[model samples]
Target: MKAIVATELGRGPRGLQYLDVAEPVAGKGEIVVAVRAAGVNFADSLMLAGRYQTRQPLPFSPGLEVAGTVESVGPGVTAFVPGDRVLAIPAFGGYAEKVAVSAERAVAIPADMDFVTAAGFPVAYGTSHLGLWHRARLRAGETLLVLGAAGGVGLTAVELGVLMGARVIAVAKGEAKLAVAKAQGAHHLIDAEVDDLKAAILATGGGVDVIYDPVGGALFEAGLKCANFEARALIIGFASGDVPQIAANRLLVKNVDVLGFWWGAYADKAPAVMADSFRTLIGWWQDGRLKPHVSDTRPLPLAAEALELVLERRSTGKVVITVGD
Candidate 1:
């Protein structure tokens, strides 16, 4: 099997090499998937550079989610059989021809969903779903603000926030990206490059009840300033490369709740929550309520380039790496 191997760290995505590697076999309680496509994420670049929270040993692949056909199931695995089409959260090693993952982490994808869409679904949708629905408890008629609203997880948050009946305000870098968010039902679009984020967000709905911020740093501070009393601010990630230090006075003044949500953590700490979240997400897809957007698809050989698209913020929605025909 051919895989993108990271032999060393701190060199970024350019350090990755597409080379022939040993095929993975199903281990106990795991299943081997012949990968059809893999989702590219910003964290892949972070992991490659040794800046992410989770670090695998050297000489590893960096993809976290994949969609493929089941090649084989390990002993004691009865939930999936060979030839099953499913998506798995492998945590690592998804940038390969085949990956072995625990059966518990794999979910059968809807028959109508393509491998490209399925490949990009789990992390972005799962993160927004769990963070907004479970953590923030976003309610209908309430004002919801999504920062970086045209990016992968940010787009999904815009869509879901609208569906959940909130009046969504989308913040993105340009008109092109803001237009994408508008099509997904954002009631208000703020150009982050031109407008004052705090004033624009406050002008639309007085103040936001919940803020979904995946691009931290200055944007987060601006969102915090425009938050409604007792607003729930969800800290999704730091895509801006700067982590903001929140002042204790701000939280106390507004009685706001700044919640940090790490979707991957649920896979290990609370597997049942992850499973239930996927079930709802798949149902929404089947009902024609969810539209997943894949901006670019590259061959497996260009896995590094796919990662680069995400790291450089050049691509909107999700970028996928196709493995085989």
Candidate 2:
């Protein structure tokens, strides 16, 4: 197997090395997958720097989601067999030619979906879907404001918000990125580089009933000031590198609800919720209501470069790494 191995913490993507490694074997209730594609995420960079909530030991691969073919199945795994095409949330070790994942965490991908799109599907879409429908209880006619609206998870929030019938205001850095958000069905686009975010969001009318914030810092502060009465703000992530400090007074003044969400936690704490989310997401995909935007696809050897694109915010949607044919 060939993998991009992280030699030490805090060394960043530059510390990764693409080299031959021992192939993973399926353990009990696990399946060994010959990876076809892997999704690159901001969490991968955080884990490499030892800053994320979950950390792997030194000298590990950092990839959260992958799409591949099942090469072999372990004992007690009856749902999948060799040659099955599946997508998995491995949490880590997906930037490799092969990965051994528990059967319970893997889902059979639709036959028509490409490996690259399937690789990018689970994390971003899952986070947005669960955050909007389950946690925030977003109403169809409400106004929704999305920060970092052209990035991986942010773009999905824009699309889902529109599908749910909300008037979506997408905030991003530039016109190019804002255009991408608009294509995904954003009703309004605000360039955070030039526009005053609070004013731009308020101009959308009725203020914002729900704020889907993945890029925190100044954007979160602005969103707090612009929130409607009894609004819900979903804290998805802090991609801007500065985690905002929420003022308790703001919540009191507006009767706002700041809801923190982590999609990965549902796998253990509430498996049924996670299962239902995937079912609905796959159904939407089959119906052409959900379109996953994969901005860049690179071969296995350029895995580190793909991660760099995410770290630098150079890619619009999801960046995928192609592992095997």
Candidate 3:
């Protein structure tokens, strides 16, 4: 089977090479999926570099979400059958020709969703959905300030915020990236490069009700001044490679709440929350209210290049590697 393996930490990927490994077969209550596409995420790069929060063993593939057709089903797997189209957040091994995953983790895909888009959904958008509605309890007509709004989860925040009737201000590095965010439904765009983000965000709306921050660093602290009183700040990730430090005085002065939203933890603690999120999100998607703006789709051979885009902070929206159809 063809797959990308991170043989060691800090070493980049090697091109696809032939290996006579036996094909994966379904285990008890498991299903084997013939992967059609895999989504490239920052975690893949961090996992390969031994910097991700959940570290896997060495010499492993690092994709978290995969979409494909069911090739076979193991014993006790009655919920699915061969030839089912599915998307899953696997324990590991998604960046391969085939993956054996627990049937309970595989979500049945709609006939309308493309394999690439399906693979892109479960992690990035799912995180945004759960974080916004469940954690923050984002209210309609409230203002939202989105840091790193051009990236996958950031753009999802923009879309979901707008869907919930919030005034959205997208904060990103370049005009090109901000333009994409505008096209995806951001009400206002703040170019963090040429201008002051805090000023620009506050200039549009008097003060933001919620700040969806995925890029943490000095900018995370700088953006705090734009939050309104009793504001909610969602701490999604540190894509900036620098974890932020918040001063106690600022919290007391602003009277704001800092929330740490860990989407993975909810998969076990509140699995039903994700099911409801998917039903509502996909319903909006099917109704033409929300569409995932995929910016790039690279061939399987260029998987490393796909990861490099995010690692270099040069990405806009979701990036995927097509393994098949």
Identify the candidate with maximal lDDT.
1
Off by over 4 Å in 1: none
Candidate 2: regions farther than 4 A off? none
Q: Which portions of model 3 show Cα errors greater than 4 Å?
A: 13-20
What are the root-mean-square deviations of the candidates from the true structure over C-alphas? 0.8, 0.9, 1.8
List the candidate numbers ranked by TM-score, top first: 1, 2, 3
Tens-place lDDT per residue, model 1, 110-184, is 787999999999999999999999999999998999999999999999999999999999999888888889988
- TM value for model 2: 0.98
lDDT of 2 by residue, 1-325 (tens): 7999998898888999998999998999999989999999999999998999898887799999999999999999999999999999986899999999988889999899999999999999999999999999999999999999999999999999999999999999898899999999999988987557777777778589999999999998998888889999999999988889988998999899999999999987898999899999999999999989988999989998999998888998899999865
The model with the greater lDDT, 1 or 2, is: 1
- Each prediction's TM-score against the native? 0.98, 0.98, 0.95
lDDT of each: 0.93, 0.92, 0.83
Regarding TM-score, does 2 or 3 come out ahead?
Answer: 2
